[model samples]
Target: MNTTEKVQTCLDFIDQRLENQAEQTIRIAELIIEDIKNLTAGYHQAMRNGNLKEHSELVRQTQLNWVNQLHDIILEQSNRDLSGQVIQALQKFVSNLNQTQMQHLHFELPSPVAREYDAQYQYLSQEEIELLMGQQRLFPDNNDSMH
Candidate 1:
């Protein structure tokens, strides 16, 4: 394979890995939701039985477990952010290479990455915008930075 094809293969691998990470995160979130429901039920049962100690313990466990899960999800997202930056840079490099080597090289690597980035900016979903808006509300003092 030539340089463009090699880079395209690498990019495809990274994209697949990113997609896997996202799916894992979603699975974690679903698990967390189930845990929350079970924890809530346990708390209610302990309260009905007047087991204050058990109720307190359940509360503590719930808090700690959810916090840990949240941390794990955040770390996963951070990894994706770094990977995304690498992908973005690579896409730019590929675009530049195509420009400078068109005459010398003969290869076509269709730029899905470029369109993916553009699509994000051009057509963000309402839910996504609301999520960002919620974050903004959480950090009202923070000045907005480039996403």
Candidate 2:
């Protein structure tokens, strides 16, 4: 795609993410609200019965459960990184766009060609790695959707 089209694609992806986030926020609020209602009812019932021991135990357990729920929510957090390999394609597109813009602005100089294999700046060779490891023929392509 052309630069403009490529940028639009990335922007569209970002916009969809924002929309999904709004819906996700509402869903989480609904869940927490239900949880809060149940906790409140339990607390009130214990207080009405004048059961100090039961009330205290319920409060402590509620605290622990709430914290565990928070931890689970945090662990399940999502975004572009976990979505797919599109982030890599988007980054590459942006780099190319910047390079093109720099060339048009007459600021970027030609890069020097490497004469020797520089391990420090080496690109990954998937085939070689798998062959050396004597493993499965391929890895799952997370780029399926993007491509």
Model 2 TM-score (2 dp): 0.38
Best by lDDT: 1
lDDT of 1 by residue, 1-147 (tens): 998999999999999999999998899889888877887788778878988797788778877988998898898899899999999999999999888877787654355654565544455578999999998778767355433
- Alpha carbon deviation, residue 124, candidate 1 (Å): 53
Candidate 2, poorest ten consecutive residues by summed lDDT: 108-117
Cand. 1 TM to true fold: 0.64
Give each model's whole-structure lDDT. Answer: 0.84, 0.67
lDDT tens string, model 2, 1-147?
Answer: 986777878767875885686577568767778877877787778778888688778778877876886665565455534543565676677778888887878542232333143434554477887685664435535675477
Question: CA RMSD for every model?
Answer: 27.4, 23.0
After aligning candidate 1 to the native by TM-score, how far in Å is the CA of 56 from where it should be?
Answer: 2.4
**What TM-score goes with each of the models?**
0.64, 0.38
